[model samples]
Target chain A: MNSPLFFLSYFVLSALVLVTAMAAVSFRNLVHCGLSLAFAFLALGAFYILLGAEFLGFVQILVYVGAVAVLIMFVILLAKPGVEERRWGWRDLVGRFAGVGVSLAVFLALLISVFRSPSLAVKAPEAPVFSIAVLGEKLVTEYVLPLQATGLLLTVAVLAAVIFASQEVTKK
Target chain B: MLEDKSIYPDLREGRRVVRPGGKREAKPLNFPARRPWLTLGLAGAAGVFGALVGVAVLLFLMEWLKPGFLGEGCFLYAALADLDRAPAILLNGFLAYIASFVPVPPILLGILSALIVIGVLIGVFLSLFALTSVVERKVLARIQNRYGPNRVGPCGLLQPVADGVKMLVKEDIVPAGADRVVHFFAPVVMLVPALLVLAILPYGPGLVPMELSVGILFFFAMGATTEVAVFMAGWGSTNKYSLLGAMRAIAQMISYELPLIVSAVAVVMLAGSLSPEKIVETQAGYWAGIVPAWFVFTPWGFAGFLLFFIAAQAESNRSPFDLPEGESELVAGHLTEYSGFKYATFFIAEYVGLFAISGLAVTLFLGGWYAPSPLLAFIPGYIWFFVKLYSLVLLAIWIRGTVPRVRIDQLMEFAWKFLIPMSFVVVVAAAVWHYSGGGFLGWVVCTPLLLVPYLLFGSAFAKKFAPSGRVYRYSQG
Candidate 1:
């Protein structure tokens, strides 16, 4: 079903996604883990680009890699993980195993849903015209209500953050 | 027994050569001297060859492959269909035989063309970067009433080559405590975004490489990642100074980025499209075929241009906003731990970033790649682009030479309290000017709207910082 170049790109991107995701969780250093997470986000953006979601791809990078990743690193630096020896126990081991089991179950469910989807049988258009102008029109006209609601929600959240921060400053 | 002269030791002879007891004048080692002319000539020859080869390939692609094999599928084929030279026709006749056997030749041709374009662009800019460094040094020297680097190849033109060789030959060192992988990756990461933004910048008419619908957004998005690389460099070094420098750099970048984007928003608002090419097109018409109708001619555009210029200076870490690399305080800042070619890579990235930002500014406000007037159209578009670009670069160098670096607090205050607020005003001004149809009445309304805040801010800034009347009361007259 796939052309040679497209198939190659898909394979490479999926491999990158897996590797970066693994690296994100596996690194001991918080900064390293954060950078790894950023890489994973970048790979996801590349995936979006390959899927012809150009605007979505750029937004993915601009929001996640540019803003969120920087915020993650900042938080990690602020809350320094002190040098301490790990106190391993059966409780910790059991917790780890439980986490792995839950993740595996989720993965299996996702796979099942993907396999069951009817859309996979349908052929996509040879070339799709989903320009930024079309997306903008759709957002404003078709989905204006949801967009405004989301905007209101975000504004309130920001106001709450500012209030909390100001309160801490006043307390000191 | 014969002993190697290189390893001759005092113990074998029972007396040391040039010992403390003996008096001997130290002589210069017979090292091989550099042949500057030879190297320069070779480089010149290579450059000429490269240019000739690039032209030949483009000509071959345009004239030879377009008509029969492409069969109108290739977009450029129709545009170039009229080009039929004797050599080109002969080449096409020969190439047609080979073209018959290839399946989907357009795909292969497209990839090859893309590679060639990218290669040529990189070569051009890299050489331009070398020239810019020399030009900056010479200009700064002239400003300070001194000569700069006049020893190498006719007024130090070959200095970049020499510096490049030195950087290459130097030993690369990484601190024992450093994260080696990230440390190495940092320079690479830093260099990439600087070059990536260059791809979208339209240099001449029909010269855009990859024109995204969200072109400006893509440029800024790439620009944003350079801060991450700065952090990586600082954090990976395992040095506290590096970390501090990185923090300062990120803070500066983040603060200035707001105003930079906002000022650009004014242009984006006026143009009604994000594409650099479209932005340039919007600024196309001339006033009675005399004064070019560039955005900079407008009152709001003037304000936006000024704001964009200052913010861009900070964004690219040019002085008086270069606290990130403040040598007096932070020991080269985020670049403290870098050595050899890694350090050179950071420098290259910095200059490239500067060029890209300057290019964007030109595209947004200065009517990118367009000649100043219709009379100057014969000069060609790309030449006009570089002339404007280098003039901005020279201005940056002049600013670097004349102004002292600002304090970190003052820098932040200037960006947030001054530039950001003023940028918003500029946007409002742009909107006002646009709605009013940009006539005399629009200019009259917008000028005061811009000037009042600017004047107020300037006076307030001066009042806040300048010495008070009661200051130094105890000092004897």
Candidate 2:
């Protein structure tokens, strides 16, 4: 695993992910778009694997592919078989312009920062055995307070969902 | 019609046989009758055959083309102390896994050895599908109670197999207006992740075929894959019922998953590792009655177990949270358009997911691979693991039969209001309790501490947020 080869794989996979993401936003058929999204998610996972982040890769696939994409498709299917848009409308054209402009601007900013500083892109250390043990141990022991905070956040989310759901019901 | 019970012998497509007086007649079996031994034998055989052929193919390729490629895939062998670079072991394992699909007899002894320890997993999977059908039938029958599939096998044990065959033989219909590619791929996409998840699972001690360190995360990821696949199935079918079912499923699974992960975090906290094998090992050892030797015995242990169990059930799309396939309102939910083997895939995937969840529970909370009592850790891990795993499997069947599916909103509220927050509180309390230790009672006392908050302020919460049942009725009218 030369860093050069690693960087090459990363570039290829990242491009694949981008291509898939583009298909997701650009596809005419909603189902096709959902699939494209899943593919992008999966490609991102492959990128994670190449980066030696197997768990992260698994998470990307599991979360985006397993749950989110299916959900979006599911929600879309609830409506009748809507006709596909044949051409870009006024809003579609304006939206794409805004999106691309914003994206390019952000990319240029990042590029400028990288070029000017030339310090952020540090070579990573080769640390082996970043197994579940290391992650779990770090999460519980070193990051205990934050872990506890995550619990609180989850609990608050639950309570909020309950309260909001209840409010919605009572108003009805 | 009354007398001629003699049935078809080929039995591929729902045929029957008749006994004329004294002679023994092979009865008119249902399409998917309880042929447990047969199904197990065949599937197990198939797995072995597939593995052998797969090995031969790889080695053949290596000899023919690339000599070094075979050595690259052997992560385990590479880790071993004195193993040479001969590609046999790696190729053998691959072949055995692939050999699972072939039909061969001479390899039975070797197959048995290969299936060893992990057999309980395959067994648990097959049984989950079998028993869930039985339980669902029994429950539906009890609700209506004329006794459900009892006529088929023992308490209608053979019913799932019958159902499976029947589903397989039935007309394979793809809805005309559906997304052709997604529709075709949905069931497979859903099922492959479900089945693959089993590969990384450590059913008991020495039972895991592949012991990846990121086991829990991998398990969660697999669950997510199934979720996406189900979403695809529902949408691809192009049916209103399925689409609605998929939405409910998505919402419900997403909401419950938060709590589920929180509960799992509790285990990662306690067991101190994410590997399923490590979790089980952490739980081994004793107190007074063999120390109960499971994470379920800690201060928040019982509460965590309950939360994890309920969430796991919900995650797997079982009762009383089977909103994904609200059969009454949504036909077969995500599976409405599926027929034959495609439908069967969904059915078995559900069962496999159920088994996987239970196996994880046993691993995380219930001292997996360790005996019912911690003292029996000496008795080999897979046995204890399967013993408890099977018990949970049975319990799942029992619950399926005994309960009815709830409304979508109610399901979400129950998770949000009752299970999720409670699990979160319990997780923190458990961590604190683990730090400040006494006995099981110290851990158990956290129960009253948590309940007191809800018990006291619950009225205010109740008043502001109307329960789902009332809301459902109000909306319907």
Q: Which is the leading candidate under DockQ?
A: 2
What is the TM-score of candidate 2?
Answer: 0.69
Instruction: Kindly report which residue stretches of model 2 are placed more than 4 angstroms away from their true locations once superposed.
Output: A1-19, A62-84, A88-127, A131-172, B1-124, B127-161, B374-379, B444-447, B451-477
For model 2, the docking class works out as medium
lDDT of 2 by residue, B1-477 (tens): 000011221123333455677667676554334564676677679989999999688667755564454465543344243232222244355555445456555456455655653564577677766765666555655665444554455445666677666766789899999888889998888788787788776754565777788888888877876667767787788898877777777778788888888888888877777788888888767777656667787757777888899898898887778867766677767777887788777777877887788888887888876666644545555566667877897777677667867777668777878777777787787777776673765656676766675575466556656555545657678
Model 2: DockQ score: 0.59
Backbone clash pairs for candidate 1 read: none
Best by lDDT: 1
C-alpha RMSD values across all candidates:
8.8, 9.7
- Lowest summed lDDT over 10 consecutive residues: which window, candidate 2 chain B? B1-10
Error of model 2, residue B93, in angstroms:
11
lDDT of 1 by residue, B279-373 (tens): 99888878889878889989989889988999999988898999988877888788888888998899889889999999999999998878898
Off by over 4 Å in 1: A82-85, A117-120, A140-149, A159-169, B1-104, B467-477
Interface RMSD of each: 1.0, 1.8
